[model samples]
Target: MTPDRHRLHDHLLDPSGGLVYHLRALRHRHGRWAPFHRVLAGWLAGWQPGRRELVIVGPSAGYGLPTGFLARFGRVTALEPDPLARWLLARRPDAGRLGFDRLDCLAGTDGLARLAAAHPQAAILFSNVLGQLPAPGGDWRPLLARHLAGHAWASYHDVISTTTAPKPDCAGLGVSDDGSLEAVLARFWPGGTLPLTDHDTFRLGGERPRRYAVWQIARRRWHLVEWADNTGAAPHG
Candidate 1:
């Protein structure tokens, strides 16, 4: 686990360490974590959907960050697994335009298929939640691959396992070794991760740096991987 994950959870419980991390993400906003999310949204803004539809997965009932940004779209649907999170979100005034569903995204392919079927044209967002998806056999590529196969999607999450690259300020959340994660994504979908040029810096939390990155898989990227896997052969490992 990285220091960022712990730092993000530091304010959740009064005892300092507890299992109430969800509250920290849902309610606390000591600049807890928003700037990076808005940066992700900015990247998403590049591709404008015809219907201005955005399907968010696991926003954890947070508001005025990514959710608020997505709400600008004509339709905003969030598939969340927590009931309490949903309740908190429903209590908000701006929730008028937002739709919440109690969906366990980690359920399986069926659930994901339904999501895709319902919002075929909507851009799917897997923010900070992809790493937490329940994937048996330690392979998360399938979960993401399934989503991209059905819709245009982008991912923003923390890469815990660091490489030679330096970290950013306003730290923490999620965990994964950069090389291993990148290897898996490249193997499944080459260059699927988008490169960040100018990003925002946060100074709310201490000097801890962030090791996060954006992962993307548009229709074209999906087609290439599918074609390579179907005709030529599975992508070379």
Candidate 2:
């Protein structure tokens, strides 16, 4: 591995880094080798774009950067809090194409409100960061409902274990009995549902298997793209 890749791998292995490690790993694996965001942007190409804006929350180095690239069809704003990552993003060529904003964190109702105010008419995309939220008490639904009532479309992705496997039950967050992320999104966005696509599996640590479900919430319909391992989970409107 290159020096940067080795350092990133080590950083991910550190316990204190937490999910940032997995996020980094996912990014390095996908971003370095695949045109993940480009494909996602193509998927969303048909949306009305003249007056629409695209906002990305919790823009990690890997996900956020590529997301910004894919969001070129509209105004893209990236929100992040990490100083080093923010610095790197600022230095990147694509920075010119996006409105990068630094935030303390993208959790709680207040943070959402701030984002809503910053990009009122934009489509919103949330990746792995949603599950990392504090949980049901954070009340993201009302914030989402208010922002997406008629003005915006939002997309979200969450990791789900298999139906027959024992999964960690998050406190204050609901998971389905079948280990489907669809239920989680449904709980978070009551009016939203999961649209089925291809089923794919991701092997994190040999035996620790996880699945991904892509969901879109717009015009009161939930369209699902089922199961694809290593598939880029970009939110579409």
Q: Pick by lDDT: which candidate is best?
A: 1
CA lDDT for candidate 2: 0.40
lDDT of 1 at 91: 64
lDDT of 1 at 153: 60
Cα error of candidate 1 at position 212, Å: 3.7
Output candidate 1 Cα RMSD.
14.3
Encode model 2's per-residue lDDT on 2-98: one tens digit a residue. 1331122212222222355446545543443233333344434533333446666554554423444543645666665444444555666655656
Error of 2 at 91 (Å): 4.1
Candidate 1 lDDT over 1-237, as tens digits, reads 213311122122222112354554444443533543444444455444445677777666554244446556777787755555667766665566788654444455555565665666677666455443444434445544554454556554433221112223323322222233345334333343444321111111112222333322221211101000101112222
Model 1 misplaced regions, further than 4 Å:
1-19, 25-28, 32-41, 44-47, 63-67, 161-237
- Please give the CA lDDT of all the candidate structures: 0.43, 0.40
Each prediction's total of clashing residue pairs, residues at least 3 apart in sequence or on different chains, is 5, 10
